[model samples]
Target: MKPRLAPYLFVTPAMTLLLAFGVLPILVALLVSLTDMNLGGLADYSRVSFVGADNYRELFGDAAFWQALGNTGVFAVLGVPAVIVVSLVIALLLDRGDSRLFRALRAFYFVPAITGIVAVSLVWGYLYNTQFGLFNHLLSLVGVAPVQWLGDPVLVKFSVALVAVWRGTGLNVIIFLAALQGIPREYREAAAIDGASELRTTVSIVVPLLRFAIFFVAITTIIAWLQFFDEPFVLTKGGPLGASTSISLFLYQKGFSASQFGYASAGTVVLFAIIAVVTLVQLRARRIDAED
Candidate 1:
């Protein structure tokens, strides 16, 4: 085999799978979105009518979809920064020590990311319980009235976002820690020789060097929060007036609960477009930064 053809040959199987599963479904969904396909239509193709852009038009006018989109935007806004900061801080702290205890703590922090979502939700539900939850109990000790963590419409967004932040940070913490370790000892030693404080060294030297890792985390974190679903789905089910309904959950409810597959497909296409645009902008910014 020619050396020039080796890389493409190796990638061909994976590319084929991506095209088959990813591209094919997207094209199929685009086609379906143009029709009024439903449960009844599924059984009888003759009953399905070609609606063209009607679903898109209806989706644009949907209050529920707009609400879901707003909620998704809020989730991403709250989650992306919190995850990046929290994970980076934890990683920085953890990287300072090279003991067995620190190693174990690193693994401990990551447990939430790998744990079952249902179990996490069940535990958080108990914690968020109005009457007998742990959080209210703690608040009571401080002479504060019990606040509705999940019941209040305004507060529920933060409550749900907090859970997502906790769950999401573990993996990013690991990523940041790996990046921290990859920095050479000489860099820090040289900074110390120049009389730079630990804080100054971190702020000026460590952080700037981790730009690529931070960028990677930021991009993935943004995508994850944009598609936020698990915690809301399991904990609140988009809850008390759809306060926590993310775009993904909204699509799921529309497609499965209401069996509005065509409409849901239209929403899915919109989501794909949003993600693509956001990602493209990020990539362009990164490229510009690299050039500068």
Candidate 2:
């Protein structure tokens, strides 16, 4: 085969799979978003109707949808910084030594990320148990009242965000650690020789060098948080009165539980648009930085 044809031939299978699984599903969803597809329509073709922008219009006035969007925004706002700062600090500490113990510590931190979120949520549920949780017990010892972890609307967001941060920290830490290792030792040594404190050297040299990696993590993380469902679904079931219902969970409830597939599809499309725009902006920012 010619070189050009060879490249196409090599990519043919993957491209076909992508079209079949990824692109096709998105196109189908877009179509669904334009229709009044629901359980009744699913059961009888006669009930199906082309609703055009009706679903999208309804979404604009949906209180639950707005609440879900706000909850997702709150989650991203709290989670992104917590995950980045904790992971970067741990990565910095781990970068200090290459001993076996330190290696084990790194592996230990990564364990949560590899474990199933359902399992993690279940374990955390037990930890958040009001009557007999470890956290409550600790508070009892200090004469402090047992705080509601997942029960109250006011506090549930923070509780859920804590789990999100803990779950996300491992992966971010590993990425930051890899980026830390890629920086040359000489830069840090030179800073030290110039009487720069560890904190100053880290803030100026290490963080600046890791900017690209940080950007990657931030963008991907924001996307994930936007679609966050599993933790809240498994932990709070989007309650104490829908306090933890993320956009994904809201979509699932509308599409599956309430039989409003078209409405859900419109929400999904809007979410996809947001992710695409944010990702493109990040890519453009990275390109500009590269040019500089």
- CA lDDT for candidate 1: 0.95
Colliding residue pairs in candidate 2: none
Task: Point to the candidate with the largest TM-score.
Answer: 1
Q: How big is the positional error of residue 76 in model 1, measured in Å on the Cα after superposition?
A: 0.9
Q: In lDDT terms, which candidate is top?
A: 1
State, as a TM-score between 0 and 1, how close model 1 is to the true structure.
0.98
lDDT, candidate 1, at 179: 94
TM-score of each: 0.98, 0.95
Show the lowest summed lDDT stretch of 10 residues, model 1.
Answer: 231-240
lDDT of 2 by residue, 40-155 (tens): 98888788899999999999899999999999999989888888889889999999999999999999999989999879987999899999999999999999998888999978
Positional deviation of residue 112's Cα in model 1 after best superposition, in angstroms:
0.4
Clashes of each: 0, 0
What are the C-alpha RMSDs, in order, of all predicted structures?
1.0, 1.6
Task: Quote the positional error of residue 110 for candidate 2 in Å.
Answer: 0.5
